[model samples]
Target: MSKRKAMPSGGSTAVPTTGKRAARPSFEKPRGFFGLSDRATTWILAAVLAVWAGALRLYKLGHVKTLIFDEVYYVRDAYTLLREGHERAWAKDISKAAFERGDIDSYLPDPQYVVHPPVGKWVIALGEWALGADNPWGWRISVAVLGTLGVLLLFFTVRRLLQNTALAFLAGYLLSIDGVHLTHSRTSLLDLILGFFCLLAFYFLLRDRDHFRDALGRNEGTGEGFGHVTGVRWWRIAAGISLGLACGVKWSGIYFLAVFGIMTVLWDWTARKRYGDPRWKLRGFALDAIPAFFAMVGSAFVTYVLSWSGWFASQGGYFRNWAAKNAHASNPVSEALLSLWHYHEEMYSFHVGLDSTHTYAAKPWLWLLQLRPTSFYYESYTYGEAGCEVEKCSAAITNIGNPLIWWFGTFALLVTLIVAIAKRNGTAAAILSGLIAGYLPWFQYLDRTIFQFYSVVFEPWLIMAIVFVFALMLGGHAASRTRKRIALLAIASLVVTMTLMSIFWWPLWTAQVIPYDLWRAHMWFDSWI
Candidate 1:
C-alpha cells in the first residue's frame, strides 16, 4: 500500500499548503515501546483501547434492568420491527413492569406512527435477535458494540491524519471516557449509531483526499485539468453510503451529507490552485465539483431510498397505502412512492412543530458549554432500601460530559478556527468541518426542544481538535528532548486528570446506586438536576 504523507497538526509551526511538499521530519516506523516493533506497538495499543472501551460499555450491561428514557420507544420499536418488519403500537395498560418481567410481546397488532426511519431500530433488533428481547442485554448490546468500535475508528483516523501513534491513542482514550458517549452507548438510542456512521464517512473522505491529491501529483507532467478526472473515487462512494446509513438512523444526517460533499470539492479546488492551475476557479467547478456532487449526493440519495425497503415491503406499516386512500396513481410502484413522500411531509411537520415542555430540554448554545445535560434515569431510595447504607441513595444516569476534557476541547476548537482563517491551513479546516457540520446546524432551531446528548455526533471531532493542539505543543519531530518531555507531561497530566473525572462521575453516568450526597456532589449546577 502507498503511504501518503500525514499533514502537520496545525500550530505556529511552518505548515505546508495543499500541494507543496514539506520536509519529512523523520517518522517512518519510529521505535516502539515495551521492546516491541513500532507496528506491533501500534496494534497492541489499538487492541488495548478496544478492550478498555468494551469493558466500560459492556460491564453490568443489564444492571439497570429497565428501559430508561428513549429506550422505551426505540427498544419496543426494535422488537416489533424484528418480528413484523414494522413498528407495532403498544397495548393499553402495558408499561415497563411487564417488559422487565420477560414479557416482550406487549405490543398490539396495529402499526404505530413512528417519526424516524427504521434503520436504527433494525440495528437494535440485531442484538435483540441474538439475546432475549425482554432484557437490557438485547436492547443495548448493539450500541455498546458500535460505541466500542467508534473509539478504535477515532484512533485509526487520527493515526492516519497525524501519523503519530501516541497522539492518536490519546484522542481515542479521550473519546472512550466521555460522559455523553458512555451514556448513549449503554442505552438503546439512535443518536450514537448515527454518530458512528458520520465519523466513518469523515474517515473515508480523509482517505479520498489523500488518493485524489496523489492522482493530482502523478499528473503534474500531463498538466491538463490536473490529470484527466482523477478517475473514480471509491472512497467517496463509501463515504456516501456511510452517510446514507446515518440518514437512515436520523434526519440530522442530512446536514453532514451536504456539508461533507461540499468540503471534498473544496479540497480538490485547493489542490488545483496549489498546483498552479491558471483557470483553477472555473476548472474546479467544471471538472471536480460537478462529479463530486453526483458521486456523493446521488449515491446518498439512492442509498437512503433503499434503506426503506422494509417499509415498502410491508402492507400494514403506518400510512403504507396513503396514496391508494387519498390520491390516485397509475401503478403500485408510483403509489408507493407517493405514499412515502406524504409520510415524509408529515414527519417534517411534526419535527418543526414539536415544542414539548420538559425539565431537561436545552438550547443548542448550551450543548458544548455543558450547561444543562439530560438525565437518562434517576431513582432515589431511603435507608434499608436497595443497598442503601446511608440515609438516602441515588442511582442515576446523567448525560453530562467530562468537564476538564470538554473545556480543553472547547479551547482547542477556537484555536483551530483561528488557525484555519489566519493561516488557511487545510488540516485545521478539515478537522473543524466535522465539529461544524455536526454542531452549527442545530443553532437554526434555538427554540426546538433538543438535548445535549445530540452533541455525541461531533464529540470525536472535538477530541480531534484537542489532539491537534497536543501535537502542536509537543513540537515537530525536530524539537529538543526537554521540549518534547514537557509537552508529553502536559498531555499525560490531562489524560490522567480526565480519567479521574470519569471515575468520579461513572456512578452517576451508569445508574449505579450511590449515596445521595455523592450524587449531589457530582451535580455542579441546579439546572443539571
Candidate 2:
C-alpha cells in the first residue's frame, strides 16, 4: 500500500502552494453581505457614494433656466442635430430668446460651419430626444448622468488597479466634491463628455496592463517563440475605441491617444525585460508594439470615422458633397472621403486661428493655479429683484475648483513626480500621463482663446495624484500602529478641509442667487471677478 502523507498540525489537511506572491491585506476585501460576496458590498458602498454624487449633480439642474456660456452654442446645436439631420446655423443673439419662448424651430436652413465634431452634440441630443428640447433639464441631463457615472468609473478603476477600497473611495469622493468638475458636469459643453471618454479609456488601458503583466509573469519561462502568446487584449481594443470617441468629442483627446499608445508599447517592452527576456526590444517591437498599434490606433480611426455617420448620411452637410462639386470624382466613396478630408482641413485652420478675444480667456499656464477661472454666468440684483434677501445680490456660475484641493493637488503632483522617478512607480507615471496629455498640449495654443473650464478634463488626474500622496502617507504594514493613526488623522484633516471648501464654494458654482457679499467672499482673487 502507498504511504499516506501526514497532515499538518492543528487538525488541518490543507496543502501549501509554492511560489505564490503574498496578496494585499484582507481589509480591502470585507466579509460577504447577507451571504453574498464581498464584491456586492463594495458595489453597495460605491452606489451609496454615487447616489450622493448624482443627487448633487442633478439637484437644481434646471434652476439655471437659461443656457449659460458655451451652452448657447451646444444646446441649439444639439436640438438642430435632432430636428434636422445635421447641425444648422441659428440666430446666435436672438435665437436663444426664441428658443426660451418655446419656439423650437430656431435653426435656419444652411448647415452651420462648426469646428468641433458631432459626437458631443449627439450625446446632448440623446438628452433632448428623451425630453423635449425646450427645457433646461433636457439640455443638461446627459452631462449630469455622465458626470455621476465617471465617479463610479474612477472608484472601480482604483479599486481594480490597486485593490484598495479606501483609496478608491477617496479618489471618487474627491472628484465628486470638486467644484470645477461639478460645474462642467452641469454645463452642456464638450469638455466633460470628452473627459468621460478619456477617463474610460484610462480604465480600459489599466485593465489591459494588468492582464498583460499577469500573463507575462505566468508564461515567461514557458515561451520559446516571440514572447508568450497572450491572446488579443480586448481591454486594449476597448481603450482604443474609447479614445476614438474622445477624439470625436474634442480634438484634444488625440494627445491622450498618442501618449497612451506610446506608453502601452513601453509597458510591453519593460514587461518583456522584467520577465527575463534579454533581447526584449527586438521581440517586443515585432510581437507587442506592432499588434498594440493596430489594436489602439487602427481601432480609433474606425470609431472616429463611424462617429461621422450622421454627417455622411446628410446630403446637405457642410462640405458633404464638396468633392462632387469641386473635385468631380467619379468614384462615390473617393468623393465622400475627399470631401470629409477637406472639411477637416477647414476645421483645423479654424482651431489654429482662433485668436478672438473673450472676457474669460485664460492662459493654459494659469489653469492649474486657478488664477483666472471662467465665469459662465453672473448677474447682480438689487433687493427684491431676483430672490435677493440682501440690499445687493449676485447670481453666478463659476468653473473654479476647490482652492485647497487644487493647491494641495498641485503639491501632490510634485510628490507623484518624485515617486515616479525615484521609486519607479508605474501608477504614478500613468497619473502623470493624464495631466500631461490634458494640460501640456494647451501651451502650444497659447495664442488660441481657451477658457479655464477646460481644466475639468484633467481634474480627475489631479485628484488621483492627491490620492497617491495620501496612500504614501498611510505607511506600509511595517509601520507602527501610532504612525498609522497619525497618518490617518492627517489625511482625514485634509479631506475635511477640502469638503468644507467645496461647501463654501458651492453657491458660486451652481448659479444660486445669493447676497453680493457672499459672492464676493468666494472670489479669493481679484482676477476671479
Candidate 3:
C-alpha cells in the first residue's frame, strides 16, 4: 500500500525521496452547479474587492483639474494619437489654457519622435475619445478601470496559484489600498498600464503552469518525458499577448518576457526529471521548450508588430519615409521595415544615454527602501483661494506608497527569499521571481533619471509576498484553532494599520486642500519633501 499525504493547495509536486518517487499527494476538486466549483466563489469575492478598489480610485477623481507630473506628456500624447494616427509635434505656441479647455486644433502636421510605443497612449486615447479629452477625469479613466481590473485579476491569480481563498483575498485587499497603486491609477501615466499588463501576463503564465502541472499529474508514469502531456496551451499564448502589450507600453516589460519565458522552460525540465524520464534536459528542451517559444515569443512578436499598425499606416510619421529617403530602399514594404528598425535603434540610444538629472530622480537601490517619494503636483493656496480657509494651505498629489505595506512588505520579501533558497519553497520562488523581473533591470540604468514611483510596477508582487508571510503565520490548516485565531488577529491588525495609513496619507495621494501643517504631517521624512 502506498503511504499518502495531503498536498497544500496551490503548491508544486512533492520533493523526491531517496531513490524513490514520493507518493503523489491527493487534491480535492470542489464541484458546483454548472461545473463552477471554486472559480464561482472566487469570482464573487474578487468582484466585491474590485468594486471597493474602483470606488476609491474613482471618487472625486477629477478634483485635480490640471495635468499632474508626467500627465503633461501622456495626456497630450494620447490626444495626439487620436488627432493624428501617430504622435504629432506640438507648436511652440500651443496654449496650456486652451488645451485644458478642450481646444487642441493647432498642432503641427509633422510626426514627433517618441521613445515609448503606442498601445498605452491608445488606451488613454480611448477614454479621451469617449469623454472629452479636456478633463483630468477623462484621461485618467482608463488607468483607473484597468487598475481595478488588475486587483480582481491578482485575486484570481493568487487563488489559483496558492489554492487558498483567504490568501487570495488578502493579496487583493492589500493592493486595493496601496498608496502607490492608488496614486498611479488616478493619474494619467504610462507606468500604470505597464504594471497592469505585466500582472495580467503573469496571471496568464501562472494559469499555464497549473495546466502544465495538471497534465503531468494526470499522466503519471505514462511517458518518457512530457510526451504524453500534449495539450493545447492557450494560456501560454495569452501570456505572450499580454507581455507584448506590456512591452508596447514601455520597453522595461522585455525583462518580464525574458524572465518568464526562461522560467517556464525550466519548469518543464524539472517536471520531466521528477517523473524519472531519461534525458530529461533534451526532451524538456526539444519537446516542451520549443513549443513554448512559439506559444510565448512567437505570439508576442506578432502582437508587437500589430501594435505598430498606426505608425505603419501613416505616411508622415516620424521616420516613416526614412528607408526610402536615406537608405534608398526601392520596395515600399522593405523601406517601411527599415524605417521601423531605425526608429527602434534611435529609441534604444535615447534610453541608454538618458542621464539628465531631475529633482525626484532616484537610484534603484533607494527605490526598494522608498527613500525619496516623488511629488506629482504641489500648489500653495492662500486663504480664500481654492476653498482654503486656513492662513496657509497646500494641495498636492504625492506618489508615496503606504509605509506599512512597503516597509513591512520588504521584510516579507526577505523572508520569502531565504525560504526559496534554503527550503526551495515553490510559492516563495514564484512570488519573488515576479519581484525580480519587475525590478532588477532598473539597476543597470542607475545613472538614468528614474523615480521611486516606478516601483508601483512591482508592487503587486510585494503584496503577494506579504500574503505568503501571513500564510506562514496562520500555521497552515494543521494549526490549532487557537493558534490560527491569534495569527488571524495579527494579520488583521497589520491590514487595518495599512488602511489607516492610507487614510492618513489620502490627502497627499489626492490633491486635497489641507492646512500646510496637516500636509507637512503626512510627509514623514525629509526625503519625502
Candidate 4:
C-alpha cells in the first residue's frame, strides 16, 4: 500500500485518531452567539456608550446642595446608620439644618422605625462613611457610581442578548438619557439602590446562561449522552450570590428570582435539546433546572435573611421583640426571628392594601406611555431669583421618561411580544421576558399609590425592547447592503433624536439653575407641568 504519506499531525488534511474532523484554524472557536462582525462592532459601540453614560451620571453630581424628595429620608438615615449603627429620627425640615450644621449624629440613637428594608440604607451609609455626613456629595456619590455601572452592565447585556453592537449601544443611550434614572442617581434613594441590585442580578444570570451554553457546547461530543452531571460551575454559583444580594437590596427582587428561575430552566431545556439529547427537557428539569434554582433562588433567600444581621444582633430594631411580647414561652432568638416575619407579614398587607389616592400616582397602563410622572421637587420663581426674566415660571424635577423613547419602547414591546410568540426567536423572547419580569407585576398593584418614576426599575428593559425593535427594523444578518444601509440610517436618526431630547431636558434632570421659562418651555403637556 502506498504508505499513507505520513499524515501531518494537527493539520487540516490529517484525520484525528479520535475520528473527529481536524480543527480548522478559522472554525477552531465558534463565533459566540452572534458572529464576529457583531462582536467587533459591539465592543466599539459599548466604548461610546460608556462615555455617554458616564458623563450624564458623573457630571455635576453634587449640584443640588439640599436633599430632594426621598433623599430627605435616606440621606439623613444613612448618616444616622453610620454614626449610631441604626437609623434615627430627624426633625421636620431637617434637610435645611443638616446641610448647614454638617453633622446629624447628635440627633440620632432613637432607632428610627422606617418602612423599607435596611440593605439600601446600608448602601447609602457606605457613601456617608467615606465622604462624611458634612458633605452632600458623599451621600450621592454611591448612587451616581452605581447608576453608571448599571449603564455599562446594560450595554454588555444587550449586546450579548441581541448579538448586535449598534442595538446594544442604543439601549445604553436610552438609559443614559432617561430622566427617572438621571434624577434617582443624583439623589440618595432606596429605589436607585434597588434598581442597581436588580440590574446586577440580571447580569449574573445572563453570565450563567452564557457559561452553561458554553459548557454544553464543549460536552457535545462526549458521547456519554445521559451521564450524571456533576461539576462546580463557579459562574452559576456567582449568579446565586448575586441574586441573593439583589433580594438584600429590596424585596421586589423576589419577583425577579421567581421569573428568572423559570427562564433559566427553559434555557437549560433548550441547551440540552440543541445538544441532541433525546430526553433533553426531562433531563434538564432534573439536572440543570433544579441545580440552578437552588443556586440562584436559595442563595438569594439566605442573603436576604443575612442582610438583617444587624436586626438579629440588636435588641431594639423595629419589631425585634414582637414574638417575645406575644408569645412569652418562645426562645429569644426564635422570637426575634418570628417577630421579623410578623413585621414582613404586616408590611406585605400594607403594600397590598395601599389604595390611598395621591396626586402623582398613576395607573400601570399610564406608566408605559408617560401619561403621568411624579413631581419630585417643584418651586415657583417670580422674576429673577430662580433665573426667570418672564412672568410666572416654575422650576421642577419631574421624573418623566423621554416621550419619544417611552412611546417607541411601548410600541416596540408589543412588537417584540408578537415576534417572540410567532417567530419563536430567542432574542425577542428574552427581551420581552425581562420587561415582563420588571413591569407586569405592577399591574396587580394598580389600586396602590404607584408613580411612573417607580418604572425606573424596568427602564433598562424598556430600552432593550426599543433596541430590539430597531434591530428588526434594520433587517437581519443576511440582508442586502442597501437594506442594511437604510437600517443604519434609521438607527442613527433615532439616536440623534434621543440625544437632542436629553439635552433639552438635561437641566430639569440635573437641577441645573436655568431660565425658569426655558424649563417650562420643555414641558410639552399640562400633565408634565
Candidate that scores best on lDDT? 1
TM-score of each: 0.93, 0.92, 0.94, 0.88
Candidate ranking (TM-score, best to worst)? 3, 1, 2, 4
lDDT of each: 0.85, 0.84, 0.83, 0.72
Candidate 1 lDDT trough over 10 residues, lowest sum: 7-16
Please give the lDDT score at residue 215 for candidate 1: 74
Candidate 2 segments exceeding 4 Å error: 1-37, 220-228
Best by TM-score: 3
> Which residue pairs overlap in candidate 4's backbone?
244-300
Locate the minimum summed-lDDT window of 10 residues in model 4: 3-12
TM-score of 1: 0.93
Q: Cα deviation in Å at residue 4, candidate 1?
A: 21
Please identify which of the two predictions, 1 or 3, would achieve the higher TM-score against the true structure: 3
- lDDT by residue (tens digit), candidate 4, 1-529: 1222222111112223332322212212213334555456566666777777778877877766667787887877777666665567766666447655775645644567766667888888888788876777888888887888888888888766765565666678778888888888777877777767767776776777767666666665666554454476566667666667766666777787788777767766655554456676678877887788788767777888888787787766667788888874367767877888988887788778888888877888888888888888777777767667776566677788777888888888899888777766666766666677778888888678877877888788888888878877777656899998998888889879977887788777877666666886877888776
Q: After superposition, how far is residue 85 of candidate 2 from its true place, in Å?
A: 2.5
Flag regions of model 3 displaced more than 4 Å. Answer: 1-23, 27-40, 221-225
Candidate closer to the true structure by TM-score (higher is better), 2 or 4: 2
Evaluated against the true structure, the overall lDDT of model 2 is 0.84
Task: Output the worst ten-in-a-row residue range by lDDT, candidate 3.
Answer: 1-10
C-alpha RMSD (angstroms) for model 4? 6.9
